[model samples]
Target: MFHFRRSTAVACLALAPLVAQAQINVDSISQDALVSTPESVDCTLTDGSTATCLEITVKYVPENLEVGPFCPAMIDDIGGIWDWDGDEAGLYRIDAAFLTMLDEMGYHFYDEDGTVHVFDIRVEGPTDDNECISGSFDEAVEMTMLIPTTPVMADAPVSLGTVAKVGVSLSGVPVFADAPSALDTGHMPALDVCAGHVDPGGWYHYHGTATDLDTVYDHAGVEGSCANAIQDAKVQFGYAFDGFAIMGSLEHDGSVPRDLDECGGHVDGDTYHYHASEEFPNLPTCLVGLQAEDNYSTNAAGGIGAEGKGPGGQGGRPDFAAMAEALGVDEQLLARTLEEAGGPQADLAAVAAVLGVDEDALRAALPQRP
Candidate 1:
């Protein structure tokens, strides 16, 4: 009896070469940056400043990949992948785990299908407002994604085989207190802590708030400089909200009845919930350590070592590099370059030169700054 398990998309890729006639084909890839045009939002800062917050955007279109059954096991009986991974029969489990992990690393996932399966993550300075035209059916799918602020190095003579893995880290701290002197450039554009995660390799990432969910104090805090070492890498992130929501006054005040109840307290129209790895013990291993923060429920990137407690356990976050391998993305070159760059924002020009794309184009591809 063939007791079949839902084969993860990553596992299929590893076995593809050995099998005949593979179905998934990542046809054409095109990208653009939304950095110059920031998403201005009214948000109050940790230091008590109410300013129009800026967000970046990045958009891309992937040509062909048999759209049917990308991950069949996780889909719901209704044939949609948005069944909240099948949690709480009533609520739509937004890929909270995936989104949280990405957000922890400064990335946001856009619900392309109006359901929760995220096609792409937003980086610092990146948002999602683009459409993807399917090459197979020429059907344009309207979707949203998180943007990045910097550029990536995928063009030119770069060796696809050289990339061994993509490393991403995310964190959220009071904008004023957590931001280091390295990221203290005056202009908010330059000072946007999100851009600090961009590298010459052009992969923009982040470790802050989301467009919808805001980081609150009751949750765990971000620790150390885990992001201080990877470069040209992508960071997952989202927008930060002050009180009950960004629109509310009394910044950081949990006084509001709903605010004290944590997000998704009563499940209003905008309420979103996701399962954490701890909650769904039956989830695929491939999906387990994929990202630090998955979305609304969990935090990612090596759990912060409680304030004043020095770096905790092993100093790294979830093993996304391993996940990248499962995704069939080049990891070797990715690893070496990041190891040498030290941090995402360091020496971006040189990194871009090495990757071979024009600096402008590279930055545009980044999800954060788009």
Candidate 2:
């Protein structure tokens, strides 16, 4: 069954806004350093959605290009690196036994082919429609995702299916739905200790909250680096496809909000928004507002385009030299990094270190993951 941490009366009062305001300022989005080249579009929402709506396009790298000291360690024989903490406390390295168990459980990973994918993500809305949009979480959108074993309660609760692109993070990485795709056979595809991982197309994305490791405690009983990596208040991490802001577990006053709906959302007077949790399925269990189409797309560099063609076209490898040039790294270094880290299954932190560069630099130099 799905589980949620309900807030007490005191906590709710602490999180309530001190003053009610007009609609959320979509223009304020430009203030976020992670968002760039914001352009507006007028959209007519059909299917009984809403009337007043706006769409915007922004350019960003797929990974958290801001904070780091990424150290994705290579797992021997396991196609990809181990970067995520399965237990929420520390990192878990997927070994042969773990892989075997996951495989038995019906989860799989695929071999990498030494290519990176990137894209210009489009976001829209904040349309005054308060009506919640309903859809099955099991429906596959981008990639064929595995159904998560975890139970969820919503307007239409269903097994967790893979979502290629869910939302965008404040650090500029794409937040994928909270399950691994069936196409992956590595230990954990696109999931790392920081709650993010690289996709097969060579783009890094998040599957959960970006700050999950912030509250992590090690053997010494001290706060982890993730805690110190808070560049801004966790109030607003990113935006969902529907155009509503995705906040963290805490409120502006540092307290959890009560009365979250089944979709992990609640209304504060006029403003409606979603919240990230501290537990499994760290993001909203489902979208409470209407979502727009064509919010996400891949570039011809390595992503699947309108014609359903990716990288080298139909099921082909990407151009290594072109990818290296786009990433601004030496072709030889890029090739060696892929070879050592296992082709497209390369670990950013491990590969970056091997090439004598920082993770941020390497990520900045790379193309966007599709």
Candidate 3:
């Protein structure tokens, strides 16, 4: 369902030969990072073919690492970091100056005397105003993912666009495509120093490949670092859904590779794989191959997580049924409208257009902003 051309964010390269590949040893991942034993399961490939896959389940947060400090309580308080797309743009620390700049840009994440505005997108769904998006941690959340034992190059590169599911890092944290832009959505998902943030479902995930943040930070001139030791760019940080290794910005020889294709992928001898960019949100924006259908899901206690949400878009929230009823709109109609507009971060303008309601009224009907 996700096969297509991503807006030319990451350069796409010409196709490489689909060479024979071997299965990654599931044991290479730490046992603590996993919630259950890895199992070989029959799965449907993206090309409507069946293939064997390794199913791995992990906790919402990584085993022992500290997470957050996202969304500052006050402008002066040190929070996390954000890739500012406004004037004076670049990756920056979420400090007083950042909040001040946001306020100037019509994003009022702070008030007089400097208390910063923040809300749990998990409980409150999305807000209509420009504010910092944050959420509480839910210990019950767990994710199960499938990695095709061997990848098959797709008809076209699968775009890992939006906050789409990218892959899981070595630390067990889920990696995601670049965040939904604050410039585009009026919501700033403040990422920690390692370029990660909590999802609306209360699970922590990366907007960038935080495992290699040191390299990305150096390239973007952001003063941030990751907890893991900097690995060689050639070392595979993790595996994409297509079952190919994901590496950093350089080749095994410590030089920038010259053969990267549109998906930032190229053949390095027998292995055809993808590379992460050195820029902000240092991730491969597309996959060179197909991924399995129903590739991942979130679950807690005994119930499933979000129904249709991806790895980055999990922890189902109570829908807008009540809100729709309050506004005298059909519940299913409102739900479908928001889903198409990007639920949890659905653009209100689009919702108003679809529902034939005034944008201001829809905003007023949403859970009042903090």
Q: Which candidate is the best by lDDT?
A: 3
Q: What's model 1's lDDT at 353? A: 55
lDDT of 1 by residue, 142-210 (tens): 112221111111111111111111111122211111111111111011111122222112222322221
Task: Name the top TM-score candidate.
Answer: 3
- Worst 10-residue lDDT window for candidate 3 reads 1-10
Error of 1 at 53 (Å): 27
Over 184-222, each residue of candidate 3 has an lDDT whose tens digit, in order, gives 566777888877887666677777766567777787776
lDDT of each: 0.22, 0.42, 0.72
* Cα error of candidate 3 at position 17, Å: 4.4
With candidate 3 superimposed using the best TM-score fit, by how many Å does residue 261's alpha carbon deviate from the native?
A: 0.5
Off by more than 4 A, model 2: 1-36, 46-56, 60-160, 181-187, 216-234, 300-370
Q: Which of the two candidates, 2 or 3, achieves a greater TM-score against the reference?
A: 3
State each model's C-alpha RMSD to the native: 24.6, 17.0, 5.6
Q: List, residue by residue over 1-370, the lDDT tens digit for candidate 2.
A: 1111222112111223332323334454433333234444444332333233333333333222443222222223322223233323223333444444444554432113311211111111112111011111111122211111111112332222334345665555567665431122222233334555433343445666665434332322332334322533356876665555778777778777889866677776656667776554467665533344445554322322212432222344445578666666688657544432423333566666656667786666554434
lDDT of 1: 0.22
RMSD in Å for candidate 3, one decimal?
A: 5.6
lDDT of 3 at 140: 88
For candidate 1, report its TM-score.
0.18
